[model samples]
Target: MIQLWTPEITTLLTRFFKANHLPYGQDFPGHIPTGRFSNGKLNPDFVASFLGIKQTVPTSLDPNLSNDAFNGLVFASAGSGYDELTTILTGAIPVPKQLGQFKSYIAKLSRIFGNNEAQNIIEKSLAIISAGTNDFGFNYYLLPMRIQQFDINGFQDFLLKALHDFVKELYKRGCRKIVIAGLPPMGCVPILVRKDSSRPSIEHVWRTRMLMPVLQWKARFTETEEGCCGSGLLEASFLCNPETPVCETPSDFMFWDKLSSKRAAYKAMSHLLVNQILPKLTLE
Candidate 1:
């Protein structure tokens, strides 16, 4: 399956938590460090490794790198969302723009491998989309405009419709296999918990509607109150530098940062995706 890391990666590295100094290397064979907002490998890295694909999914935004569709490309950027306004506000690449880049990549693949081969690859490829978290965390709740325009349920509907359109566009581009990730329980996230625990639990109606599955997962974690890295209150990305002390035992903690899951948590999630989620997707 071909992979893409659009605004998700950018947001994770640049804006979300800021892990600028982290080196990009295959420190874990199949896991390449690209300044992800996590203690170690992100969910995508684990998923790709589990699927026996190449570890590093290169960002398509890089100007120097050759467009190699065989290895897969990451179109996701941090702070990006399903909507254009979200992209504009956050300065992250929009989902539609990422799709546009995908189209270009496909064309490049066609040139290299011929149309039939490129089409075959595209049809067989699995596209994993992990977005919408920023839409809520960065835009709807954080910004005044979206909240003013629509109430909780209404905004949820709007975002869902946008997601529908994004999937439709991917289908149109000959992508048959697609997996759209749902939002995690925002209440349990370290940043939200530290900021205002009551808000994520009570005010976030969107979380209440879609958090059952995540809540079930929550029962597995013991360190729900804080992150594993540093103080866990505000430390994240670059803020979690060398000077900052880390937990002696990370396995005891569920999160690695203000908004990211630890390696152990990702491992559990990867297991779920492989055992439970993949089987169903493969069946389809």
Candidate 2:
């Protein structure tokens, strides 16, 4: 979370400037905006639905949330990444602070369910961790803040180490069923593409080569190049605010904005990964 007298993220939540929660959810099934970066549900929400735990996985920071977190909840920050600097620059929650929030969530659980049951709940729950894209896109590729210290390869290594450490911390805290989503095609994103970044990182090698049935694209979507948002070249976040014109049919597009995929794309990925992850998380 952003450091202050008290932690706050004024841009999306916490005081008033909610940039992402207006007409942004125009394509959502419920037609309700919930501050997510996309037009509708995220992959984690679809994952929860696939697992039959809940139709929607609530965020941990929901203002009206109660003590019962048994079905699980999201603890993600939209613009955050593996690097603390990346998070700091965007006023998003950092990795360590996210863990701290999890610790607090556990303590609350302990008070309600008792220590043993709380620990048991954590162990039985499934955790989905998604990050790293912003580390390369925001820090290295966009700003060159970390480029002064590390090349793209070195930055990738540093992020991988940070991710390992985060996962280890989660394991220590009793998370047994954990799934990590790797980087998306960031170089092909409208924002990065407009930035003139065409060269893909080494991760692209595996992303293009690996023959994983789970992640294999079915090619259901036709619009792979431009986002549905205005101009489909540079609009993202605040730039993709209300009053901006969007395409009539977003489901045909792979991306909703400059950075994120459309809800349809996430739903597709959710279906694929759920089959792969469900067996592992459910079996013993």
Candidate 3:
């Protein structure tokens, strides 16, 4: 009897702009443009490469695209959050909607590969869910609804529960291996650090609430004061154009835009994931 092992996995990155490929940053041309928030490769890009899978995971939102489960897919949106209201307010795809897209992708895969093969792939695929920061950055801090309803701790609990449900749903859909990324050092993000020194530090709060081990990349960044692109205040995507003044040494900068980290930072993060995180996931 031939012993079957767990199938190779597909992972999802949740949250806004985390997977946006708009305006096509680098490497990805018009033929395979993405809406990623960063100036170059995000953490997921490196994670995919480290897993020995195809590096460019196509965004599921593209209308002209077809299912390519072997290469993986990115369902995240910039400005999106775990909360439905958050996506509605920011005009980004909500977490639930991203999952819905995954469901649709699975259906298409079933049509092409048959039910059993699709189910095996789904069972083996890794689901990477990155969220929460936007709920704090865009909603609780910038908006008023969540603040009016709950204090910082209360809101954190709400988001944690939402995350819990998201993972639970993925498990229900046959995704056995799920990786939920904890929030980065949001306080250290150039835009926030430059804008508000008085802002209370929530890094500890996020770490504590999530109960997941955090990846540290602070030591790798020398330019923590501002982003490499333009003023680094709020510039991103189209706002960060070719005409925008960039730093002479982008590798030194922690961020490429107001919200997204530079390639160097993400590269460090990818190494951490490959060395520390991926080993436990039992990837082939």
TM-score of 1: 0.82
Deviating ranges (above 4 Å) for candidate 3: 1-33, 64-67, 198-220
Residue-by-residue lDDT tens digits, candidate 3, 107-196: 877898899988888887877777777788778887789899999999989998998888787888778877777776677666676676
Q: In TM-score terms, which candidate is top?
A: 2
lDDT at position 140, candidate 3: 88
lDDT of 1 at 138: 75
Using TM-score as the measure, name the better of candidate 1 and candidate 2.
2
What C-alpha lDDT values do all the predictions have? 0.68, 0.68, 0.64
Candidate of highest lDDT: 1
Candidate 2 clash figure, as a count = 1
CA deviation > 4 Å runs, candidate 1 = 5-8, 11-17, 22-33, 62-69, 198-221
| Clash count (model 1, backbone only) | 17
Selected candidate, larger lDDT, 1 vs 3: 1
Name the lDDT of candidate 3: 0.64
